[model samples]
Target: MALPCAREVFTSIFKTGAVTKKFCGQLKQLGKVCNDAFVKKTLEDPIYKNLSESAIAKKSRKTWNTCASVIDISPSSSA
Candidate 1:
């Protein structure tokens, strides 16, 4: 049921700004986490759902300034 690694991955995506070798190593450690806890619960968390949705949504920003605002807010809340 351990979930710290999963949380670390999501946070690192924002914190590191890109996936690195360390990030991949962190993913490998997720095998230590139970499938039900990591897959069935954490990934299904509402906050994760919202973050995934926002990231994939094809939204057109009306202005340059507004684009920065949306990018700024999403990962902060997600992580």
Candidate 2:
């Protein structure tokens, strides 16, 4: 993924924001393996030490599935 797209995704996951459709395309291109790996690595962060790993994993799966569905039904855009 491009740096900006990656940053957007990181913010959406760890902070307060949503990933734009443009970045969704990038994430789709990267595929689930990369996405899961990203989440797995994030689970190692100290900030998430107190959080439940299973909960985070479940949420991450939901995010990925939502993005997948959105990209599937929506027309592709240049933005």
Candidate 3:
């Protein structure tokens, strides 16, 4: 389940402003593809799906909390 080298990935999609939201959207699309592929590949693996409900909730909460932390609250913020 290893990925390609970072240099190879960057060479295929690199551009100026590649770290911006537009580029992020591209990455998110790729992420969805990768996630679906992973789930497809691992659906039969009970270990991957054995997490407790609370563990799943904690992970979901952590994701949103981290996203909230990244929000720019100041009017003068460059973000």
For each of the candidates, give the backbone clash count. Answer: 0, 0, 0
Model 3: CA > 4 A from native: 1-48, 72-79
lDDT of 2 by residue, 38-60 (tens): 97798799987887777666666
Ranking by lDDT: 2, 3, 1
Q: Model 1: how large is the Cα RMSD against the reference?
A: 12.3
lDDT (0 to 1) per candidate: 0.34, 0.74, 0.35
TM-score to true structure, per model: 0.29, 0.74, 0.30
For candidate 1, report its TM-score: 0.29
> Residue by residue across 1-79, what tens digits does model 1's lDDT show?
1255444444443223333344344444433233223433544677656455333221111111132343332211111
Candidate of highest lDDT? 2
Model 2 misplacement above 4 A = 73-79
For model 1, state the Cα shift of residue 30 in Å: 2.6
> How far is 55's C-alpha from truth in model 3 (Å)?
0.6
For model 1, the local distance difference test gives 0.34
Clashing pairs in 3: none
Quality of model 2 by C-alpha lDDT: 0.74
Q: Is candidate 1 or candidate 3 better by TM-score?
A: 3
